[model samples]
Target: MKESEFIKKNSVFWRKLKKELKRSGPLTCRDTFPDDYEKVCYQIGLSRQRGYNLELIDSLDSLALRMRQELYRKPSLSLHNLLYQFLVETPRVIRGNFSYVLAALFLFTLPAIATYFILLKQPHLAFVLIDPANIEHIEDMYRDNAPHLGAPADVDSRVMMFGYYIKNNIGIDFSCFAGGILVGIGSIFFLVFNGFFLGTIFGHLENQGLGYNLSLFVVSHAPMELMALVFSGAAGMKMGFSFLIPGPYTRLHSLRKSSLIGVKFLILAAIMTFVAAAIEAYWSSLPHLDMQSRVIFSLSNVLLIGAYVGLLGWKRGPI
Candidate 1:
């Protein structure tokens, strides 16, 4: 295309970009900035090749530079940035995949309910999913007067358990996300398996008169850990959905785009999982935290998380 025609074709886009760059959180879609940046760079090259005027070349080059900085500059790790990421960006990303979240919730909750009722009717059925040895261990761990719950009494043991919790939690989260590669079936399986497993444990505990003890131990961390799994399951389903449908783009491109979005979902999942692991290893197992205190803390966390995700996510933040 002639330089004049090319300029005419893209001037509107450039103007929009300029406007967006002036906005507080510039870049309408941060991920899409690369495509826009590359296009601008290509335009600069084309103008130079066509022997366009120096004024126009310089103008395009300047715009390209602005875009490049936006695309590649290291974001500051300021408090404001962190707050915005957690309060605004993370929730926005999650809400965008709300349908997938609903799907994940359905898969998880339904199985849990089913298994819980089934195990209540015949507690022995818990052995189907949980090993007999593990059931015995769980019974001892949640005994009414148990000293440490699942945690050990020593500081070193607690530290080791902290690390182990993080490792184990993250591993589960990664599995929830990576399972999308099996066309979402793997993700579904994992969610159902976990939900059923939990129900099995809960049912068996209640049967053994350890329900209150079990709740006291898990309440502090359950909200965050469950949220993390839900996020990861949604992320997995999203990737699988994109690959399965591919709408307008090629299968590969669709997969690539969804996977990028999935990575953001996993970011939230990882943050929640890490928090849950910390609480489980330390706060949940703390000997001094009474049942009422644990419930209060857990309730506060749930309210905060729900408000942030439900309220902040639904509305645009100042940042």
Candidate 2:
């Protein structure tokens, strides 16, 4: 076509393009223009070869406007996909027997509760259970050539009392947390055994007249330690449940997901255990602590446990 004749023929088209550009400030050509500035120049070169002065509008702002419009357009979201992912994927994560871990940890408390009965009958056991370093003086009633209770206070037994607490508490917490894979059976067994042992030991101490002193030492820190164990149990149950009822995903996939949750719980448990150990070592064992002080520490422990349980419920209705 002749240049003048083609220009005349496309005059109306050019007018419409100019009008759109004036209204939308260069975004109008978003459909036709290339997003990249260099690419837009390339297209303009082609348009000029076809006898159009598209170069007259070559600028960064024009190119950027076109690019933004092209990049911003997206398909609308609908309820179908949202519902499918929520209904199908979310349940597999939420529904399961996480309670078993808590139940198991609760069982561990039994030993602590029952120790009194043993301590009353077998006064010797109090000395046996009393940490060797904490025992005040040597006496004959202890069968292992060990010091009996009611002996003079040693006042200066230099050992890593705190270190022992940390090591034992951390180890037990990890064991309980990881053991949930037995579907809480292992954790529960461990908790019950520990609880009964601890209870009996304390009971023994109370029978021996050292109970108040020991209470001043333990009540401050045992709360965090016990709560940490319960959290660990929850972590383990999380893993076991994932294995038992892996809904849509293969067992392996479910295990991987559950394992992650387990790890998170285990890590939190470990941190709490460490905190408890620090408190037990430094704050709880102060010499000559009074009754009011002991009561305050004991009450604080209850609050901590209650707060942890509350946390479990706060996130979602208990797993």
Candidate 3:
């Protein structure tokens, strides 16, 4: 019960506990954690009761706290865990915020539909929405005899395109998400602008009799690309809405709370964009698949994506 006697009795155990805590790599303390932790808890109580030196008591308290943290800490990341997070947690988050997704879809689609109709009626409007040079370039690319329409021909070219797509897509996603801090006007603007511009291009292509070629080139990746962009816009809007209507929390707290959810959506959007780019660079460009085959493949992609997003994480509960 004397302070000196207590210290002598517990010093060896404390040293061993510290050594175990400092071990590199995976914690090998799991098997003995319960006993060691309980023992430390008891030691701390005894040290206090015996009027031990303040330094000794403080060290015991710190050790006990560290043990508790180590015992309850989250598991380290692994391949399987990462896959589960992507395949499971990501979709769950999306589904939970399906309203935002729907809003994003509408925001992007309505403008596109309107612009498509307008451009279809008057093809010259395409020049207004898109640069004249870019319009010409698109027209040339889809021309019947054009050589490099779908994907680049060489391996290096494909890789370069892939990298380009990743950068471009990520940039767009970041802009859309960051725009939320502006109270969502930026997100809305970018989404509508992009949708209208794209629709104009499609309408112009159709008027020029290149619709089939353009569809063939874009159909394979359109679902993924379009959905990803929508999700990005949705995330931004969600954050913006949080700011506008923070409920009980202060504006700053609401923004922070919404950001947690928004970041997940952004991450999912990036993944989808990466996937779209891969397909665009490789599968979408296969030269051999006719227009019908390409359309079928594209439809299949839509169905697959729908199924994955709708059902992959169902009934699994939260991550």
- What lDDT tens digits, residue by residue, belong to model 1 across residues 78-136? 89887777778778888787999989988998888888888889987988788899899
Task: Give me the candidate number with maximum TM-score.
Answer: 3
> How displaced is residue 202 in candidate 2, in Å?
1.6
Off by over 4 Å in 2: 1-101, 118-159, 245-249, 308-319
Name the TM-score of candidate 1. 0.73
Ranking by lDDT: 1, 3, 2
Per residue, candidate 3 scores C-alpha lDDT tens digits across 20-97 of: 888765454568778889989988887778777899989999998888888887888878888778788778878888
Residue 132's lDDT within candidate 1 is: 94
Mark the regions of model 1 whose C-alpha exceeds 4 Å error after superposition: 1-84, 150-152, 313-318
Error of 3 at 208 (Å): 4.5
Q: Estimate each model's TM-score.
A: 0.73, 0.53, 0.78
At residue 104, candidate 3 shows an lDDT of: 86
